[model samples]
Target: MPMPEQADAAKSRAPSPAVDRGLTVIERLVTADEEMTLTALAKATRIPLATCASIVYTLEQRGYAARRVVGRSHFWRPTLRLYGLASQLVRKIDLSSVAQPELRALADAVDMPAHIGVLDGATVVYVAKAATAGFIQFDTYPGKVSPFNLTALGRAIAAYLPEDELAPLLTGLVGGRGPAAGDGSAAAFRELLETVRSRGYAVEDQEEQAEVACVAAPFFDAEGRVAGAVGVTGFARDLVDERRDKAAAGVRQVAATVSQRLGCPATALPRPETVF
Candidate 1:
């Protein structure tokens, strides 16, 4: 047993139990597939009911979490505040800065319009674009966003997603009436995902933009998370057979180069097709 003074001093220096409880609650709600109730959160964190309630109230006040009341029981879950903050961090990333050279090289190698895009909700947002020197290419530009199921860029990222995560995404995209919604149902969607995974890239042949063809490959970050994707777009006729295959190889090569620069292991590289 220690003296009262010593025990009190040590307790004062420790981290706030309230803050620890709050953070643990946030993590639990964020990772949960379904909403959790106040009792559940308190039990999961082993925090006293009153303290958990107070922390949850504070989070709600800050718009970081929300609750749904059903009769006497209330369910709580994290809100999109984290996602909004994440987007702010993404803006600071300057993906185009490091990826410009690769984008340009891809455009030159593929002789088409090249773009780097990141997944934004159910859409893909183009952040960088390059065109073959002196060659006119139309339709895609920086800041443009397209439905995930309709763009090769989006599908590339989707290919690497776990089934649990991918199912809801594809279902949501379909619910939004994306152009590809008419193509098939759940089974067909699964097949599309399977094809993309097997090939190491996603191919869209005149699927989104009329007479336009595209191939895209996803790139990983230092932690091996899919950071974004690189893609080449061109006319349908120009993207057939050897041409399409070659472009796929080029896209994978450039994405791999960038991924490597970001510290991704060579073993993790997804090479769809070998250069002929």
Candidate 2:
């Protein structure tokens, strides 16, 4: 038998030239600004033209790349199947771990507690948080669940969901047990979602607790889908009126950072009137 180090080195080497060539073609298609013809792919990857044609044909058959024919020429580009596979892997990532650093930074910047939450049916479940020192701690922790319409974190994500998905969540929301809860009609809630989309963030001014409020913004995954949200919670007095804009900006910035880390393109992020 070979020595252990040699065996390890052998295991690390490319095992299949055909598979390597196929992956190279796929990468070239994915990174190219425009579709490439077979000749271009062969030249770029330095594979024989016949070999490159076979690789691309296999990729096309497997739904990883697509072909477009113009007149007699065939051009190829990557398909969303690759993105779908990537999104599946992204979904398995520990979202709380990904957002924790940004959550801490947001808490320190806003001098309040910050949280990250994901949607669970019609509710938002807090999965991680960063608490500030010297503040009266709010009654919230990881695993806390709140109605989607009653918290800024929830609203931030809900606002970006498709209408078909949001409609079911809005069905039974009728003025929950919050001091500031009001106008739970679907029409009113739809209007609120529109505002969230327009402003690039959501606010719950004393909607969950009599003395507390939150400002939040949605984060996205590589597929441009709402993955979760990041929010800061503070006394209602500190999060409204003159102070609200600063807090909202901080929350949006954290959301943007976390979303980018999750593979969301910068262009896919929300652009409120106030640039981040």
Candidate 3:
């Protein structure tokens, strides 16, 4: 019962139904486990078949979706255009800001100090940290830099690097220092990285500091490359056997969450069982 002018104004401000249906179709295609036929997409979106076809065809023209012919039917799937836009948005965000809340959650869950670190040359630099209340804290800070082989955070990130990139880092660290417990030589360090890769997580058991231990897992970027690592540090006596396993699982889960937020596909992440 409104005036004609008022009704026209309201209609003009409303969202476009066509745009909404087009987005719905795109989302359905993107989330489908396999390429969807136009019929399947229409059924999933509850849009009419001809309308869905038009929407998909428009998407294909815009480089957002691709069509494949299988048998007698055509199947549609989302292209990398959406992923490229997502990658650009993620690149503009800060890694530490994205990881801070997850680190805090990890600290509370494990009752220890949790941290995020990034590889810098031959060292790993801590960029953010969260400590549980009433817990004994370690002598670490945001800017603390430790040799790559001496910390779980470093090992977690290094384990995923290609040999061509890892060899130089190992050479620099081992050749410039005396034999250490975890990194005695380049060969030994390579062996350790192999173990870390197999397990999907890394552990530092009193290797760097007395009575201190840490567990960490790597998180990747949209390009499926290791971007950084998340770790929890505590007393070695407290992080043993079952406790260590639990902490390792927690760290892996948190890292996976951060990776997904950074536009990494779920398929690219390590399986949960691999952490154990």
Model with the higher lDDT, candidate 1 or 3: 3
**Residue pairs clashing, model 2:** none
**What lDDT score goes with residue 177 in model 1?**
36
How much lDDT does candidate 1 score?
0.81
| Poorest lDDT segment (10 consecutive residues) of candidate 1 | 173-182
Q: How would the candidate models be sorted by lDDT, starting from the highest?
A: 3, 2, 1
lDDT of each: 0.81, 0.86, 0.86
Model 3: which residue pairs collide? none
- Separate clash counts for every candidate: 0, 0, 0
Which lDDT tens digits does candidate 2 get at residues 1-276? 899999988989857888888888888898899999999999999999999999888888998988999998999999999999987886788877886776787788778898999999988999999999983688779999998889999999999998889889888784655688788798998899999988899998866668888999999987689989988898888887756887788788888888888889999775533322
Model 1: per-residue Cα lDDT over 65-164, one tens digit each: 9999999999998999978986776566677766787678778776899898888888899998997765565778999999887888988988887667
Q: Model 2 scores what on Cα lDDT? A: 0.86
TM-score head-to-head 1 vs 3, winner: 3
Relative to the true structure, candidate 3 reaches a TM of 0.66
